[model samples]
Target chain A: MADARDAEIDDLINNLDRDYDFHPGGKDNAGYGRDQADNKQQDLQKLLNLWIAERTCPDILPYDEELISTLTDRLRAQVEFIEMTTTDPEAASQSKLKILLVESELERIKFLIRGYVRARMHKIDKYYLHLSTQDTDTKRKLSDAEQRFVLRRATQLKRFYDQRFLSSFPQALQRLDDNSPILPMVDTPDLNEFVFVRVLQDVPGEVVLSNDDSVDLQKGNIYVLPYKAIRKFLRVGEVELV
Target chain B: MALPLKQIGTFLPSEISFLAENTSVSIVPRQALDVLELIGLNLPAMRPMRRVEVPLWVAIILKKQSRCNIIAPTWLSEDSLKAAYEAEASNMTRFSNKLPWEWIEVGELVLTSAPDDLACPPHIIRNLLRDIREIRQAKVRAGLKSLDPTYMQIDNVGAMELNEIRQFVTMTMNELRVLQNGRAEEEAEEEVEQYPGEDSDLEDTLETTEYSIPRDSSNFDDSLRSRSRSAAPLGERRPTSRAPAYEDDEGDEEEDLEMDESYLHTVKDNSSGQR
Candidate 1:
């Protein structure tokens, strides 16, 4: 059910689990205990990442329905298990300390998730037009709900423009043709221009653009190519935008 | 002509994702003690050896004082990083979620701030990090070779590397999308060639103010033209209105042909209104 987005969410979850363990491993209680701890941590971060993803890209399809409930259940079980378990003073104190860290992290993650969502909603409401007609690739960033919202908004805008602005304008002033599909006017930031990229390696390669012009990419030197020319290199991480 | 499109910077997915990222760090205090009255701290007690999660700056301060040992995040480890690199390298078609949102920066931060606390030497970790980043980047290039821009997930990646990739990927995806829809190619290829020419243009345009226009907008050229045109007796209106039509016929030639239609529309609107 969870596809490409799965890997990133899982990565964050796994990190939270592995990074927060305070238990120093011994023979009897090494891998198994750590595994349980790791799962608990992973579960929490999974939720955090899900919230973050929703907030960051509200236009994408929503997350798997069962993911949150399953994680929350597992987390609850883990908390109960921790509470019931008994140990020596050192290990008991350590678990107590570990729990605090996990809870604090959870709080921090929630705060950030809240802030991110608020910021995105502000942008979405403010630039609903930009969000609506964003190229499909960019629109993929929106969650299903957001996608629906943008679609509705796009239709409303198309109608508003068709009835009000486009109807009033003469053929010379009108941009889209009469038969052309009505998409909300796209106000995309220009992406085909040169960007400040610092070459990260020494691999020298040649890039051919739409015009069949080749630009040489030499590592350790920064060269500004029409983004079209070096789009491939940028993705491969050979060049970093400064 | 397209209604004057807004050149909003925050609209970029990369920029928004960068802003949304959580770069906060957590550290375990080395020694616990009674709660001392600190100006910002709201905590009732400070226990030794307890994990006190703090912002990156606060973590830095505590680490500097040798008061806490930074819990090197899992993504910073050699084995996990290598695994992530392999995942990224093996699949050119997709960006793996093997690393955190700000994985590169987090790894760099931990290495720079708490080298001694890590399982391996800082230099070795640095080398490993470099290898991973390079491999993943190479994979991105390989993905681009397919010409199916759908495979690229710009959101999964972040930090400095994403900035360069974002511009290209966003443009490419946008171009391919418009091409499929049979729309006019608004994705104009500008004067990115002649690196020196681009730099000179930027320098010439940017000399007037300390504020630099973002490189990603066509507005840079618009602003540049407006600056030069500021001397001319066009209207006494704000400089933001599109440059006049007669000026288009005059010596101040436009840099790109794609913007010409919009400019002409502006002229038509201005002329018709004035009459």
Candidate 2:
């Protein structure tokens, strides 16, 4: 069930996968081995891209459920292998060397996952005031776990503030979502913030950056432009932040 | 709470190098090693004297163990470095798109871990890489001098090079935007007053910076009044307190906007993002 925000990107990615030629002429061991290798490499690349995008963008992105679950399962099985296979502290030389390589890779992947989740949590916490009060479309950005986290965070903050000074104030004054005209009380992310975006495809139309500047984002060109100007392009997978 | 948003927004040096470690490099094993399934990448079995592709981190590990001889990527050779350097030196305005995004990091990594495997002497390769970097760095500084709040091209730029300027570029762009938005709203707010002094500076900035890529300079006189109204209202609201100061910056920006257009053009094509 893809939401409006990510549905286009989902379709595009699904189409790309369908168009991909996976494991052609796979009867031979070499070909089959290469196919599996390519799949794992693709997964790693996707994870890396997601990690970097989350870190670079100011707002929280939709949770990557499929990629996360698959990688977590693989991580679990690898951890089990490393744990169970070590009956003797001193194994064969080749096996020892093999285990070393596996552990190094395992740590790197773990680091990436940790960075991704932590970046999301940071955004969720900072923007909980805005996200929790927004419409359902905004709420869809959270995963089940993140949804729970934001709920508890919102409730806890409300209670803490009520006990501190907000309880003494009149009901109308206690509202944190007060649309303070000069400055927004309900801290929302600034979408207009400039970011580094790499064009993934030839963007069909022109983007009017200012009254005077407009650019046609062709495939493979990198441009530094506002995140909001290319938000749709980012969601539809036409571009990615560097 | 998380080292401030600015710090978290960009990558640290170690983090950049860590990402670079995943770059695939070819290596020849000194002894046989079995196939091993790992979480991110699957390792194929290796036989002595047979070449195989592996991540740079993995290559470094085996090289440390005297298990493999790392092969430099073709671009890391003396001829490639010389050619890249020559191209860079010849062009003062733009960067040569020939070098990969992580050229600096990869060059540093191989030089540190397996210099013996490089075709040329490590010192010569290091000097060429250094000269190319200096040239590209000069180009980057020149590009930044022409910084406008709106949009700019950054093709063929390296990951580290971008990061080095990340803090300054982002801050300047964001600040410039606030200034632009604030001035327009101020103009529209006092459309009757038109503050002859302030309005003149804003017009100059808009004419020089935004007009660089969007349209012809001939339309400047006619579009002045309409442009102010359109650029108003939707600029993150500028916090009201900083509005006056942002206006002050507009005066200084008029000089920066007078840059030649050739600095930020036509170089990089294939950008392997953050790789």
Candidate 3:
């Protein structure tokens, strides 16, 4: 019975123009145009409902029913608009408006279908991997499952690496200055020069003045003392120059 | 009026004097001399105007230029120019054919710079002949049929053969170089004759840079050598299928054993020794 009805519908669709027109010549027949338009609308609604039922999962499945509904509603609205505009000659005068509405409705449907297909494919891949993991003991079974996992992971890592290294590194490196010092404290001399000078400490004073009492500085291994006494060294060119 | 001797070197004074003595003429200023020079006549030559008879055709062409009043007779004509061009071309073609073969080869080397562009450079030609003969002997020992007569003919001497193509190119380049060194009028004619058909082929193969054989040509050499090698061994393997079959149940168990037995049989038969 359903097949018979579908055949009938197909026949009507195939000869839609001939059945809907009044005559070959231009003439007005409001009743005939309304009936034909109503029949087309019914056929379109039936087709859209069948497509939605076949493609969309039930509420239990993780699928976007709201997006699907929105797309269907927009498509239904366009069908209604096309029917209304074509039935009345006066309303059909805005050809550009009709075209714009039809185009926008098609674009929306295309975007929704693309999104749905991408999401559905990703879900199917995940489901296949899960099922393959369960049969781990068989030799061929494990290898096939592992190969699938490797391919999926490789695709994911390739995308991540491209985004991280190839796209972002150039701009990040361009923002740095060459002269900016990385460690300023270690490079400054004031902190180290005073500490080196403090290292030369004298023992308890044995009146450590003696001849020409300038402060008697101890000679560390790095420092050397001349053979002349301190006061003689102070006198005008008296000590041997070393 | 004859040009003053002082102005002879500064302009086309000889042509001017001849035009002045021979025809009705006008003197164009130095500024219009450039325009006159472009039209293949020197302006400084025309002076002391008088009427002379030019052909109807020459007068009609000159009348359209708007620069000068048409003299009845003009010295230049389209037919005379075309005849001069053809005469010059014939002289160059005659000269090119008489050039020495060595000089032709040298000229070809300068043009193409490819060893294969000149009769395989004599040494390669000798080697190719020897190799083809050796390959033929091997084919006989292997009981293979002689190569097709057409291929042999092409190999010996044909247009597409390497050596023949080389000789053809050498001859062509020698002709071109001769044409290049000919008189200017001859050179112009030669350019028209040589460029239209031959230049496109030469441009495709003979790049201006030094020629080196493409690295991928090793594959061509490999294919040639392998084909020669395959032709020799094919005869020895033909009688192998005639061996008597022995039904042994154990033979089915080992594939490698069957291969080894057949290989040994082939070796023993070829080596003329008992297995």
Per model, state how many residue pairs clash.
13, 2, 5
- In order, what lDDT does every prediction score? 0.49, 0.75, 0.31
What C-alpha lDDT, on a 0 to 100 scale, does residue B108 get in candidate 3? Answer: 21
Candidate 2: residue A60 lDDT (0-100): 77
Judged by lDDT relative to the true structure, which candidate is superior, 1 or 2? 2
Docking level of model 1 = incorrect
Residue by residue across A121-201, what tens digits does model 3's lDDT show?
A: 433343332323333332232234344663575466546766767456544232111111111111111100000011023
Chain B alone, TM-score, model 2 = 0.70
Candidate 1 per-residue lDDT, tens place, B194-255, comes to 11111133223223222333323334565343332221212112123434443345443333
Whichever of 2 and 3 has more lDDT, that candidate is 2
lDDT of 1: 0.49
What are the TM-scores, per candidate, against the unseen true structure? 0.38, 0.79, 0.15
Model 2 ranges with Cα > 4 A deviation: A1-32, A88-93, B2-6, B190-275
Docking class of 3: incorrect
Best of the candidates, DockQ: 2
Write candidate 2's Cα lDDT for A1-242 as tens digits. Answer: 45875988888998886556443445455666777888899999999999889988977788889999999999999888887667656664437887788888889999999988988887887788888877788888888898888888899999998999989976645665543222234557767788898999999989988657799999878888988899999999999888
**TM-scores of the first chain across all predictions?**
0.40, 0.84, 0.25
Residue lDDT tens for model 2, B1-275: 43344346788877888999999999999989888888778887899999999999999999998889999999999999999998898888878888998999999999999989988899999999999999898899899999999988888888888888877887678767766765565455654332223324433433333324233323445344344323322211222222344455455234224111111110111111112
Give the true-contact fraction for every prediction, in order.
0.00, 0.50, 0.00
Interface Cα RMSD of candidate 3: 46.2
Q: All models, DockQ values? A: 0.03, 0.27, 0.00
Clash-forming residue pairs, model 3? B16-B45, B53-B72, B53-B73, B54-B72, B54-B73
